[model samples]
Structures are given as C-alpha cells and as structure tokens.
Target chain A: MRDRINALARLVPVWAVWLGYGWVAPWLIYRGATGGLGAEPIKALERELGEIALQLLIIGLCLTPLRRYLGVNLLRFRRAIGLLAFSYVCLHLAVWLFLDVQDAGRIWADIVKRPYVTVGMVAFVLMIPLALTSNDRAVRWLGARWRRLHRLTYAVAVLGVVHFIWLSKGFQIEPLAYLAVIFALLALRLPDSKSLERRTR
Target chain B: MANRWKNDLRARDVTPEAVYLDRRQVIAGAAGLGLVGTGRAARAKVPEPNAWEDITSYNNYYEFGTDKGDPARHAHRLTVQPWSLRIDGLVDRPGDYDFADIMARMTIEERIYRFRCVEAWSMVVPWNGFELADLLDMAGVQAGAKYVAFETVLRPEEMPGVRYPVLDWPYVEGLRLDEALHPLTIMATGIYGRDIPNQNGAPLRLVVPWKYGFKSIKSVVRITLTDTEPPTSWNKANPREYGFYSNVNPEVDHPRWSQATERRIGGGLFARREPTLMFNGYADEVAGLYAGMDLKTYF
Candidate 1:
C-alpha cells in the first residue's frame, strides 16, 4: 500500500498541484465580483483567503509526520506546499490591504496598534525568508543552515493560529480547533529522549 | 399620526437605484480621485441609505448566528406570529402586551437615521416606527424608573445560534431612562415602508439611532423598567470590548478595531471607508443627553 501511494504521488507533478491550488484565489475574486460571496463580499473574500492560507500551512505541517509515522514519503512536494502557503498568505494580505482596508495610514496604524494584526503581520514577514529560500540553489547554498531557517514555519503557523483566535469576536471554536491541530502536529515533531540519546551515541 | 418631530431625511435621499446598480462604476470613479480615505471633510454629506438587499442580507443578529449572512439563512425558522412583548417593572400598565395591540396604539412614522455597528461598518436606515417615549407614556412610566431593559426572544428550536453560547442566551440590552425616552429613540416595526424581514428583527425592535447597532436589540420579547443598570449581552460577554453605554463615538475606539472610520455597506469592492461621525452623526439631536459625562471611560 505504501509503495502504491508513493508511486501515485510520483505520477502527479508538483507544478500541477501548485496550479490547482492557485486557482482558488481567482475563483474567490470571481465569486466576489459576481455577488456570489454574499452582502459583505470584501470581508468574506478576505476571511476565505486567510482560512485557505492557514489550511495550506496545516497541510504543509502534516507532511513530515505523515512520512515519519506512516511511511508516506511525499517529501518531494514539500517545497511546492510551502511556496503555495506563502503565496496564499500574500494574497490574503493583499486583499486585506487593497479591498478590506483601503486607507494607507490606517493600515499601518492597525498593524502597530492591533495585536491580532501585529501577530498576522509577523507571521507573514517570517514566511518571506522561507519562501525566498525554497529554491534549489538557495537550498544547496545554505546547506544545514537552510533546514534551521525553515524551522521558522512552526512559529509562523502558531502565530497564524493565534492571530485568527484573537481576531475572532467572542469565543469561536474554529480558530481554537486550528490551535489544537497545530499544537498536536508540533508535539509529533518533538524528539523522544531515547531517540535523542541514540542519535548522540 | 405625528405629534412633533419632522423628517430630516426624505425618501429621495436614499441611495439611488441607478447608483446602487452601477456601484462598480461609482467605486472606480471615487477611487480614481483618491477619495477613499480623504477624511472628515468629505463625510459632511448625509449618508445615503443602502439598498434593500444590502440592508436585509448584511446583519449582526447573533440569535441566528455570528456570521453576517447567518441571520438571513437561519432566521426563516423564527416564528414571529402571535408574538407579545412582556412589559414589566416600574410601569402602571405592565402585562404581556400583544404585538398587534401595541401597533394599533402607537403612531408609526418613517425615521431615516444613521445605523453604525461597533465593528466599524455602517448604513443609513429609514425605520418606520413610533417613538419609544410614546410607548413608555402609554405604559405610564413611574417616577422611580431609571433604566429600560430589553430582552430578545429565545427559542432554541427556532434560533439555531442559541445552541451556542456566543452571547448570554436571550440577548439582553438596556438604556438609561432619559436615553430611552429621548425622541430620537424608536421601536421600529418596518424598513423602507415594509414590514421588516425576520432576519432584520421582525415585528418589533428598538432602534436607538445615536448608539451602536447592538444597543438597538433585535426580535425583542421583554422590556423591563428598572432603577438599577441592566446587563447587556455583549457587555456581559466581554465588558472590555463592549460597554453598557455603547454610544457611537468615533474618538473612543473598540479594543479590537478602530471606530473612527466605517465602511459603508454596498459601496462596491473598491469603495473607501468614510470617517465615522460623533454619535453616528446624530450628536446634534442626542448630545445634550450625555452632558458633563466622560464618554471615553463610559465607552
């Protein structure tokens, strides 16, 4: 079954996956323009894009655990997943900046004054380095340093979830659920004492 | 039907059907002139009432759900017929007043007032209803009454959002006796010459124009005249975020978002947010009510 899964994963191109996922933003924009996104289309579109970006980040986080525990070696597509998440995050920020909040001074004020926006901006800023280094040349040049830099993803994911939770009015379950899943994924990555001792020996 | 007040805003002042239909063009024209965030000088003109679709579809009634569209989707289950408002506490005539009976006694009129939400979004609504003061007079407000408390209908089977504790169930709101008695305050029964849709607080709802939208509680079921301050749903949920005196003050921002500017609903995709007015542009009418009081601390 594992071999079959690996073969199936190889059959699909990473660029195809990228293109498929990339189509969502334009589709949402189309929906917004056509009045399909309901009364508050700008807010709806902004939230949907943010949610999609978070979901993509969650998917990217799952790759390591899936490969380690279940022998689902989909490591080849990790770069594509990371870059897609980054792209979606940029799109989400763009929508918020251009459509939802059109004022330049207010945008800067929000980032500085609002804690949720600050956290969201921090997460977006962190993703920039990871996205820039996703290329093969950067990976080869950075060597061991590349993996260390990419570990920033965990912090970015946690901050993203925190931002969502903080931004939501009242106590909402959806953002809390994201918080739980991200924590569990991070927990799975923790090195067991025995494994650590063995590796040191 | 009218005793004293005159309509300041007319039906023609409502957003034109042509403008509403061709909002994209208007938005583009506005954007080209860099008019999106020009500040308070540009906001002097009276706000145009949003289209019927925008007013009905976009709402913050959490009884149906938290999402803006949730009320429109789930409010169909709400049964507004055979409704009665329980008017109790410091009143001479206190009983389960039937909805139709109340309507017959009160004089309803069109009150085109600016509606601002605490979330920094706004609309101009032409509410058809009578002054709440008139209703209080009929009930015979006792001298001891200091506050007017309101409660929304709580039908778990009907209101799906009630299943979750988004707010204290049976959403409650309150106003100071003077604030409640203010001529600007009305119990709206209809919108734009039609009975309000179930999603937009059907049958009867308090419409306190100068305060935030949530202060004008929807789908009201009870109104209690009391001496002590009453607990409001949002204030109870998060006092830091929401206050008992949730007046629309542009200077006093909500903890989460800015209240200085508001996005006008139905302004199309690229529309700029206009600066919010003090007391939602009704300060001239209602400002004297809060004389010498600290709005920032109260907010």
Candidate 2:
C-alpha cells in the first residue's frame, strides 16, 4: 500500500503538466485573440502545445531511465504518464482540426496535399491502437502481442520528433534536446540488457 | 491488398502511388476523397467581409509583436496612405512608386490559396492581388539582382515588438529571383474582397504560395533587389527552420517535425489528414527552377 501511494505521488506532477497544458492552451488562444496576448495567439498556442507534447513524451519515456538511474522504481507511474501524453496530444489535435481551417474542402485539400500533416496524421493514427490497448483488460486480452503492438511507441517517438522538427521550419534548440534524450534512451536499448545493468551499477 | 475499400477511401492518398496501386475505381475514389463528413453539420457560412476583422487584428509578426494577432490590431494605427515603395538596390529603375501609381498600373485578380504555416495549422484565404513579376519587371531588376528583399514599416509607437530585438527591426524577407517570379507569388492588395486588413499585411503584401506563409511579407513599405541573398526575419531568427526558399515541401521536414502532411482546417471528427505535396503541387510550373540542386541541402 505504501509503495502504491508513493508511485501515485510520483505521477502527480506529470499529470498536472499534461492536463495543465491542455487547459492553458485555449486560454492562451483566447488571450491572444482578445488582444491580451501578442500578435499570433493561435500560432503561440500551436507552438506551446507542440512543445509540451514533446516534453511530456520525453518525460514519460524517461520513467524507465529514472527507475534505473535513481533506483526510484516508480513502475506504476508509467501507465498514467503514457495516458496523459496521449490525452495532451488528442487535445493538441482537436484545436487544429476545429479552430483553424473551418472549411471542409480546403481542409481536405491540405491534408491530402501537405506532407507534415501526413506524418503527424500517421503518428496520431498509430497512437490510437496504443491508447486502446493501454488498459489492463486490453493488455491481458492481447497477451504477448500487446508488447509487440505497443512497440509502436518507438515509432510514435520518432514520428513525434519528426512532427516537431518539421513544424519549427528551422532547427530549434528544444526539439534537438528531446531528440538527444530519445537517442540516448534508444541507444541504451541496443546493447544487451546485462550491459545496461553493468553500466547502471 | 484485401482491404481495398479501406485503402480506397483513405484521405490524402492522392499520390500517384495510391492512385495506381489501389484497385479502386477512379471517379468513386475521387468522390470519396471530397465527400468526407459532407452532410454532418451545416457548413458555417464563409465569414462575411469584416467578419474576420476582430480576429485579423491581433497578428504576431514577432518583430512587430510576440502576440500572433498583434500585428493586425497594433498595425491599425500605421499610416498606410501616402506610401511610396523605394525600388532601390540592384534595380535599374531605382526610384519610388507612389501607392496610387502602383495600384493604377496593375490589374487585380482574386486567387484562393491554402496558406500553411510552418507551425502545422493552416487557413484558406481568398486574396486579391497583381502578379509580383509584373512589378519586378517594371522595377527593372538589374542583371546582378539575384534576390528580392522587402522591408516592413517599423515604428515602436504602434508595434511594441520593435522595442526588443526579437529580430533586426524593419523586418526583412527575401526570395531567389525565379521564386519571386513564379505566378503563384503575388503582390496582395485585398483579401476576402476588401483592402488587405492591417493585421493581414494591409496596403500591400507579398504572397508566395509554394513556400511557408511567412514568405508572404505583409505591409510592405519597401522592395529592394539585391545581388547577394537578403536576410529574412525568420531565417535570421533561426536559419535552419526558416530557409530562404521556405517552400512547402513534404520531404524536407522542418527541424522540429516532418512536413510530410498537413491538417486542413474544417475537418470533421474522424476526418483523416491529407498528405503534403512537393512544391505544394506547383512542381510542373516551378520545379525546373530548382533543376539539379539538392532540396534536402537547400531545405
């Protein structure tokens, strides 16, 4: 019971950051639109969301690393972080689909014609299955395949990075840092499990 | 593929590969592409003129203001009339074109273009303008003029963004000689039928469709032809993300994300995102300009 409480405690901040990001974005947009914020409120919102999504995903990915390095072993917090990351991304997408385009045909033309949207769409689409299987029942039902399927998160990480990199138009310092973290995490996965254990020790 | 219907009905599969590979009939496939969420909700009537006034006013030029919509609202006080464009630098006809003279010399055509910001969201705006090439020709770009640079009016009184050096003041943007000449590039005077709103780069602006939206410079007070490449505001702010061409190409992803596809605004629930095209579908017309150059490198 004490261990469970500790794990839940570890997840609280991550959830706050995740949920807080969504709640703040529209307010920012409203502020921007109402002359409370600077010139491009919508752009600001889009940027802020993109950034938070990447950061949270990185934080969620870091759970395993945190356990190994700090000996924190907050394994229970993992699902909550993953779910929160998914929630934030869903909100990020909802804002784009509803607020910006407002036209059916033109919006259709853009998704069909534009590439960044394609990669982002693919990333979003792949995420749905992962989210669907996130619960314990779905994981149990799928059994071993669940691990294989959830491996899509790796792709999600890659797509998320690509989505971010392309959105910036130029190299941005923040996304590069996320990429480095992902790279280091992924590089650790390449060597044998014992190798990581040895290094951590 | 057994899932022909699924593949057939997928949005953004307009690429030649999908067109040829999917065994679906062409006409039905085309209709499916267009008709997603057709009867769901009553389509909102296109905003009437000045309908966007409230929204357009708060534009973010970064150099003008950090707020996205700040430029439009703040720029309302800018003196647009009595404006004369200084056509100097590498132009043979290096002189001024009074606002009236420039307006009288050109014919206005309305073109509806999809504007995709590098940020991923997009808007479709109907812009009224004259071909930019016509004006460039009148300016008589000298032989050495390989680039065109534009300068926006900078005043701290109206635009507080000018106070802090987010970018060099009197924001500048540029284009290679040919990209400037592309027919898709325009000197915009009006949008949605009225004068270009102050927030939307009123009085006059440049619209480069193939490129990201910022390539479309707004509220132009000066146009300078240069032999060397001009420093664009976003490019100067972050060179890797905002390139000189800054054209909408899916393959050359921005450093933050892939440009492989974009979400068109107004999509309904379950509406799939569309794939972004190379050269924003102007390859046949403008592809020759880039010829053998490496897009990945230039990008």
Candidate 3:
C-alpha cells in the first residue's frame, strides 16, 4: 500500500501542473474577462501569472531538500516539477511579451532600461536552456555532463529570487520569504547531505 | 449611479492615450510648450462613460501590502462607520471633524481627471469631491503654514499588513501650501457618484490629478498644515525612487521604471502606450506654479 501510494504520488506533479494551468490561469483570465481584474486587469493578470510562475519554481527547488532532510523522496517526480515550472515561466514570459507589452518595438527598451525588467529577462534567458534540456534522451546522452549542466538550475533559482526582489516597489514580505526559502533549500544540499546526494545521483 | 456625476469631459480629452503620442510632439512643436490643450470647451452634463473599470476593489496601498491586489482584499477589515478626520497643526480650528459633519459642510463637485501612477500606468477617473482648498479655508490656515501634510489611518487589528514593516506605518504625504490650495487638488469623498469604496479609500482621500497616484493618499485621517515639508511615506522609504513632489514628469525617469509612456487601464492586453504628459497634461493650469524652479533638481 505504501509503495502504491508512492507510485501514485509521482503522478501528482504532472496532475498539479495540469491543474494549475487548466484551472488557476484560466480562472484568473475569466475573472479578468468578467471585469474582475479590478481597475487594471491587464496589469493584474500580468503580475498574477508572474507570481504563479515564481511560486512553481520555488516548489520545484524544494524537492531535493524534502527528500534529503525530511526522508520523503519526490525524486521520481522532479522532472514533472521542473517541466511544470518551465511551463509557468513560459506562460509568464508569453503574457509579458504578447499581452502586457504588445509593442514588439518597445520590448528591447524595457529589457535594456528597467532594472526589474532586466533581471526578469535574465531569469527568462537562464530558463530557456533548462527548459529545452528537460527530456530523457538528452539526460542519458549527456550523463555526468547532464547533471553538471542541470546544476545551472541553482542559478535559475537565484535569478528567480533576484527578479522577484527587484520587481517590487516598496519593501515586501513575499519576495523576501521566497528568497529565504530558496536559500534554505540550497543550504540543505551542502556537505552534510553527501550520502543522500550520492544516493539521489 | 456612475452617470449621475457626468460632467462634460470628452472621452478623448480624458483618456486620449492612443491619440496623445504624436499629437503631443506636434502641439509641442507648434506651441513650443505643449499647450494646444484638449481643445474642448469644459462643459457639464451627464457623462454616460463606460463602467468604472469594475472598480473591482483592487488597490495598491503599500501600508496595507505591497501587492497591487492586496489592499482591496484586505482593506475591508477597516472599521469606517464612526470615522473622524483630525485636522490640526498650523490651522485655527484644530479638531476632529466627524465624517457626517464634514460631508454636510462641504460643497461637492465632479472632477473627471487623468490619473497616472508612478509605476507608468494611467487611468481617467471621475472623482466626486470638494476642493481641498475649501477644506483648508474652513480650517483657517495660519500665516506660518507652508505645507499641507496628510496621513492615512493606521489600525493594526483592522489593517493586517500594518503589523509588517512594509512601510513606516501611518502613511504620510504632503504638498506645498499653494499646491494644496489649487482648485485641482481635492479631498475626494466618492467616485462615479458612489461612496468611495474601501479599497479606493473610503471616507476621505486626496486627489491631486497633476501628480502621480501616490500623491493622492488614500483613507486619510489626519490633515496637518505645517511650516515645513512633512516626510512623505514613499520618499522616506526610497528617496531616489519616489520624490515628495511626485508630479508626473516624462523627463525624469524613475530609477526602476520608465516614466516616458503609460499603459491605460481597462484597454486590455494590447493597449497603446501613450506618452506621459508633463504634470499629467494639467501643464496649462499647474505649470505656472513651477515656473522658475527646476523640476528635475526638485524631482
């Protein structure tokens, strides 16, 4: 029964992403369509998608720590989590590129001029390679190099936190909380967890 | 209800986002100071404009939370019924004016103004209010008064985010005495002919159309006329990013965002970005106020 439950749980990541995209994004879009995005629906929608993407990335980063320290392995589902996070990031970028900022010409200026936009674009740039390499054939062919390359995910996580922290106007708790959580997860992967890390490898 | 306060403002005159870009350059080239004004006679009548963007209760009050949607979701916890504004400092009649009494004594008017946020978003809102100058007149400003400072209500139990140091609580904003007394500066009581929504700043708020939205402090409870500039909340939080004289300036870019263009609210995802105006297109009326002083240096 325990083994069955663990097997069932691996599918949770796949279903979770589907649920998030299928339900959450559309619900917000519907609310926006129905005049629920408040005085500035476009802005609200744009920010909301970005937030969801950031949260999913944060969740994806949590898998390693949860297994090593807490003795609960979601290792089998890490691919799903990573892919889901990538989808969200893609959606977030699409919203900004196509919807929020419609002018193709002005996009370069925003990416170049605004610090928040610059940091966010940097995050998107780091995410593109990671998203492209999220398949089994690539993972097998690359082998040890694949793990080394995938380690760039940590930088993606760092950029994600930096992007959020810089994007906010005033001092905020949410962005800081995300920073703390990401750091804590990275900290848990240090020297002491060598045995767990090797086993996971 | 929204139609009741319909003053004769051309929809194009108020929004003017799509048409404003090149038109401004032409006007600037022709007039040399960009004052080929909206060119419409200011008339008063039923507006019958589109619905008020659903006013869907979303707000961006950092004292409440940093998120744009956080304020509307959380501001309802405020207990507003028995509210009173403490009018003090540099004024003769320094006392708490109960909400009911203040409403009865004030002369209400409809002002459809172009609203701009410091974050480079813009909206055209029809605000219902009495002139802030009239309120100052009622308080009999002392000769020494140099600035009119304002503060938002701070109730920890009611305002959940106040517990966090999102900002130095009891949000404060101030305006120069002359700016405070300008006819365009108003103490808004309502919008779209309806009582101001809690998220929109219930009971009372300031509306300085020429300045960015932060200058229009929300849920105001304190009005202090002072001899010096009062510390504004955002400026105190980050001076480089937010100036006390947060008048909409396309020339002076915010450290983080471009002030050159603004996306009009409710124009959906593909809204045309309009060139931001100097003093948010109230350059005709308020530009003279800053005649000699360099806005860049002050900003």
Q: Name the top TM-score candidate.
A: 1
Evaluated on CA atoms against the true complex, candidate 1 attains a DockQ of 0.64
Model 3 collision count = 1
lDDT of each: 0.88, 0.68, 0.77
Show the lowest summed lDDT stretch of 10 residues, model 3 chain A: A13-22
Query: Per-residue lDDT of B219-272 in model 1, one digit per residue for the tens?
Result: 899999999999998999898999999999989988878899988877555557
Model 2 lDDT tens row, B99-146: 789889887776656577776645555678888888988888788888
Best candidate per DockQ, number? Answer: 1
Across A112-173, the per-residue lDDT of candidate 3 in tens digits comes to 98777888888788877777888888888888998888887888888877987897867788
lDDT of 2 by residue, A47-101 (tens): 6666666676777677676666665665665676677677767767766666544
Task: State, as a TM-score between 0 and 1, how close model 2 is to the true structure.
Answer: 0.56
Cα deviation of A132, candidate 3, in Å: 2.5
DockQ list for all candidates: 0.64, 0.07, 0.42
Error in Å for residue A172 of model 1: 1.2
Give the runs in model 2 whose Cα sits over 4 Å from its true position: A1-201, B1-36, B39-60, B268-272
Pairwise TM-score winner, candidates 1 and 2: 1
Better of 1 and 2 by lDDT: 1
Provide the lowest-lDDT 10-residue window in model 3 chain B.
Answer: B40-49
Estimated TM-score for each candidate: 0.93, 0.56, 0.84
